[model samples]
Target chain A: MTKPRQWIERTIEVGLFLSALLSVLVTLGIVGVLLFETVGFFKTVPLLDFLTDTEWTPLFSEKHYGILPLFSGTFLTTSIAMAVALPVGLISAIYLSEYASRRVRTILKPILEILAAIPTVVYGYFALIFVTPLLQKVIPGLSGFNALSPGIVMGIMIVPIVSSLSEDAMHAVPAGLKEGGYALGSTRLQVATQVVLPAAFSGVVSSFILGISRAVGETMIVAIAAGLQPRLTLNPLVPIETVTAYIVQVSMGDTPTGTIEYQTIFAAGMSLFLLTFVLNIVSYLLRKRFREVYD
Target chain B: MTPDKTKALSADPTHAMEKDIAFKVEDLNVYYGEKQALKKIKVDIPTHSVTAIIGPSGCGKSTFLRCLNRMNELLPNFRIEGEIIFDGQNIYDKNVDVIDVRQRIGMVFQKPNPFPKSIYENVAYGLRIQGIKKRDLLDNIVEMSLKKAAIWDEVKDRLAHPALALSGGQQQRLCIARALAVEPEVLLLDEPTSAIDPIATGRIEELLRELVKSYTIVMVTHNMQQAARVSGSTAYFLLGELIEFDETSKIFTNPGDRRTEDYITGRFG
Candidate 1:
């Protein structure tokens, strides 16, 4: 009986190890594929041109391969998303963490989480059909498929992500510190801003970084709403194509596998991966530093 | 009873005229939801003296202390009846600004809780919240407050260091300095030395004796010796009631109540 139990336990341990190893193997496989395809693409397009070229017209007859226009579009949309999400998400977090009653929080948190649960494709259509038209009424010159609409919609999409994580950070602040602030005659606002916010600063900052990473990696909303124009303009009023949107466009079209146009998606995928990779590392570092300080 | 008559009776008639009272708590009943934490408590905490509230764990001594500065209001389902009169006005009155009340009554907690900022920033925080932006003034007050807390000489050179990096004793003193930067009228300490070493506790007790000269001191402590050593008057609480309130000497030597005697001796808390 003991031998049979031991044999079963050994099998289970090996099975668990293999399950854990599968995820790492898949991640390594992705990195290897991205590297191979990117190197192949770089052989046809020089690294300098890829980095410094102002325009990206690979599918067009012109055949320019500069990654800058796509990068600028990605940066512009992400900026708008950050601008919308940061203050709104942070304020919501502060309200939920510092001001809201337990009952209100219990009711409100699920509703906010539901906002996150909505499909990104629905958000995409909403941006194109609803948000753009609304903005056109106000601004008059707003494009039907512009960066601003998708950018704002993406911001709204990620608000729960930013607010939920940031609220968790603020809530982790010790009650004694808050009571100390109150004992010194600090008003509720003063305590929230002065003491709790600063003590939870690193975690809040990490949450923002993660939110930005989500905005950078988001695909469906930008693909459906932000138009297929790889213009290197900061103007949110004009239609722009982000890196993710460009990949979706190439993948859906007749780009022909093993062609330079086909390989552009992999190259674009590499850039997006690298950008989010750096962001995740920074976020992880900040979170670790925060743990050292408080714990 | 009439308001005047209740006031006259609550304030010890023997010392009512002579004693300078900082707080006159009358029929202050505290409830957390349906459960009562403190029964009808009436006591006149005198000014410029250390008045210690001593009792066993879960005796509502800390709850009574928290009520003086209205800190109990932060808890959910917390309800209070009766009045805590401070500066001749009922602090719990609807017209009274809680912010203003808190500024006058500062509290030090059991564990050292300094903001994870520089020592200088922690001390200046209270003043900064009040919109006191003058740098020179803040510097002077921070120095004075730290000196008063008896940690200036140890930390004078390292004001820019993170407060959490300091020893626990120094951190506690930093909290004290932070509280003092606002120059509150009454200082409430809830087991301030319970988390510190014997040496640190002694230094804090010595600091309290000096502080009472300028600010009214109300303390909640479990250590009977600490109450006898630092406080002028002591209030013994059992369960949720103020069993006895009198001179520290009398309470230690000859308590008015049998329960107080039972507690002060090696009997059950």
Candidate 2:
């Protein structure tokens, strides 16, 4: 009877360990799949042409396999998105953490988080129908489908990401710091700007980097609203194609399996993966290096 | 005779001796939302003297100190009904700027809360806020304030190092230097040495003794011995009520209330 009961307990422990192992396996499998296909893609297409060539036209008869134009478009849209998101998100975070009353914080925090919960596809539709037309009205030169509308819409989508994380960072700052400033005769604005903001800076920077990563990897909004033209232009008013948009475009087309056209999608996927990976590494390093944990 | 009787006898001489009042509180009552934190408190703080408020935790001693400079007004739920006059001006008056009041009546907190900036910046912050742009004046003021706080020798060489990097005692003194840089008429220290080690605490006590020669200082301390050593005048409090106010020597040696006696003797808080 004792041996049977011991066996039962050991079996349960083994089951828990196996489940934890399986979870790790699942993560490694996804990464392995992305890497395997990406490697297969580089084999078919010369690495230099895929990296350095200016044009990305897999659909045309004379297809040029460069990833630069897609990268530039992705870079441009993400820059615009960050430009819109960083200041508004950071200011709102400062207001919530430093100035807002309990009632205002309780009500406004949930409302800001609700923006993050809205689906990306819905943002795509809004960008396509509402934001695009709105931009056209203000700027006569804006194309019917341009990167500006989607980038701005993506900025709105990413705002909560920046605001929430930055708020958490600002909230972690000791209340004593602000009290110290007040004791020194600093006004509310001065304390918020000089003391609180500087203390929470590394966290704010990490949050902004994470927001940029989210903007770079966002697919549906750029696909629907930002037209699928891999033209390398800095102007947000023009139609452009990001790396994520190129993947969606390739996946939707009727290209035969194992063909160069199909393989080109993986190449773009690898670029997207690399960009976000670097950003995540930077976010981690900034948090670890600069964050001050008060006892 | 009881300590209370002796205190009553000794109090008259100090009251008769002093002619100037640094701050006067009249029937001050403070409330946080529905909770009354400070009962009717009326006391006169004498000029160029060290006044210590001694009480158990949460007994409105700190709250009363904050009231002198309207620092309690920063809390959202904090409301008060009373008059606090500093240097012949009603601090709670509608026309009076709280910022200006704070500038004239600087504060040092319980924990050493130096800003994340450099030590030089922390000491220079108060002067900078007043829009003093002359580099020479700022350099002179920083050196003088640090010297006054008794931390100049320790931190003078590392002025550009981050203020947060200082030892706990050094940081607290740095905070004091920051307050002094503003050249306030009064200095309110809310448990300024509570977070430091005993040796560091001794240094702060020594500094406080020196400071009262120039600044009217009101300190709230949990350490009974500390109150005895540093203050010229002492106010005993219990459960939001001011139990007794008298000279520091009399309060420790001869208190006028049973509660004050019990508190000082380590019988009950």
Candidate 3:
């Protein structure tokens, strides 16, 4: 009974709603699949055993299923990556926002962005070939496939994310606040560090959280460079396997569908998802706090 | 159309000036690229008194205030000619450190722009940057500055609270306290009370009157009444030129320039 124009508008409205719902549906589907397979994984391996077991050698003749090794590996690499990225990215953002001229910023910003555009696979190979060999010369005991090289490479890869986002946050701070600082006779460095950085604290913290989440979920870089040995050790000189690397290794191999070993990837994925979800929540809370202060 | 005050000010730049001059601006010309913002400005600001610069928007009043602290140099393509003599040295001299100039001539803006920090930290920031790490000294200075700014009683209990939590007027007072913490010789205010409500504006005017007892104050304000109420002397500017400079009472009652009189009487901005 509707007119043609009214019908067309209704159709478009439905289509837009469907488009919005599609992403949410896909996310729910992913969570359902991960939960289903993780449940299947727990049927064979007890929860306590999965949590407490130190060795993660499910593929070997003697099987073990502790999540600790993967957790430790992921933790170690992410820590190293953060340690490298935090200072470097923050400093670059300060230079870009506070010190660099408009022309210099225009030139330098795209160069930093290009670092993000570089393929992770390329970075993986770079970690294995160039960085590892160089580190081997400097630190004699470093293995060919250790956590250090891949960690550093991953840090280099995520620098753009931290810098670009943090810079946006710093840029968002009111110019009036900075003017107030300069009026108080603060030098350029003091204005940047004391006023701008603190004012943009929530945004900067959000960047750090995002960078850590990206490092945790990173696959190819650690898979190719960091060896597939899931050992519960913090030593960067030794080979260690991250949760993502193990998932990648399992997904690539000839393990049959729904097998306990294959289902292990889903359980590992769930843990990764949960960790990133927690990080995102923390970032959201911090950003909310910032909004409350300013608004 | 008698231009008595204008002729006197233009003929002798230091006419009716106090012996203790805080600043001597001589042949000052400011340009932002091709456009001139301030044209051939010459005036002497006396110490320990409020000197209000009154003009319509874009008349270079704010530009003139910023020049005293060398804040104009921070902008792109901003150039200034002539001398701004402060502390017996030309602040525009190549060898004179800008940091030192700013330290001596602190400024406040139209809107209260407090840092997103604790009330205590906001006041203590100036000394902290100067590397004064002593806890007792910082505590003493923060208390003294807050008291001087007339916000100590309101904010004393909430020193740890965020500065942004305060009302707009309180925040302005906090900013004033922050500026006072550094103990600058001159405090430049660029329409500081324009953003606040009348009650807040009255509080600030009264505070300024109290402050002029010790520190030199140069403020740019659009409000003629505020200039009359708070300032000792008033400089009337029109189209980037100083039209008249005289006592606040004389300038209000009988302006020297026709432009100054017309603008003051609300005939035209």
Candidate 2 residue A218 Cα shift, in angstroms, is: 0.4
Candidate maximizing TM-score: 1
Q: Candidate 2 residues B59-143, lDDT tens each? A: 9999999898888888878999988888667899999998999999999999999988899899898888778889999999999
Q: Per-model C-alpha lDDT, please?
A: 0.92, 0.90, 0.93
Any residue pairs clashing in model 3, and if so which?
B5-B256
Better of 2 and 3 by DockQ: 3
Per-prediction TM-score, chain B alone: 0.94, 0.93, 0.93
Instruction: Estimate, for each residue in A215-244, the C-alpha lDDT of model 2 and write its tens digit.
Output: 999999999998999997888999999999
For A188-282, candidate 1 gives per-residue lDDT tens digits of: 99999989998888889988998899999999999999898998999999999999999999999988889999999999999999999999998
Which docking category, incorrect, acceptable, medium or high, applies to candidate 2?
medium
Extract clashing residue pairs from model 1. none
Residue B159 local lDDT, model 3: 99
Give the TM-score (vs. native) of candidate 3.
0.96
Off by over 4 Å in 2: A1-9, B1-19
lDDT digits (tens) for residues B54-84 of candidate 3: 9888899999999999988889999999999
Order the numbered candidates by DockQ, best leading: 1, 3, 2
**Per-residue C-alpha lDDT of model 1 across residues B195-230, encoded as one tens digit per residue:** 889999999999999998899999999899999999
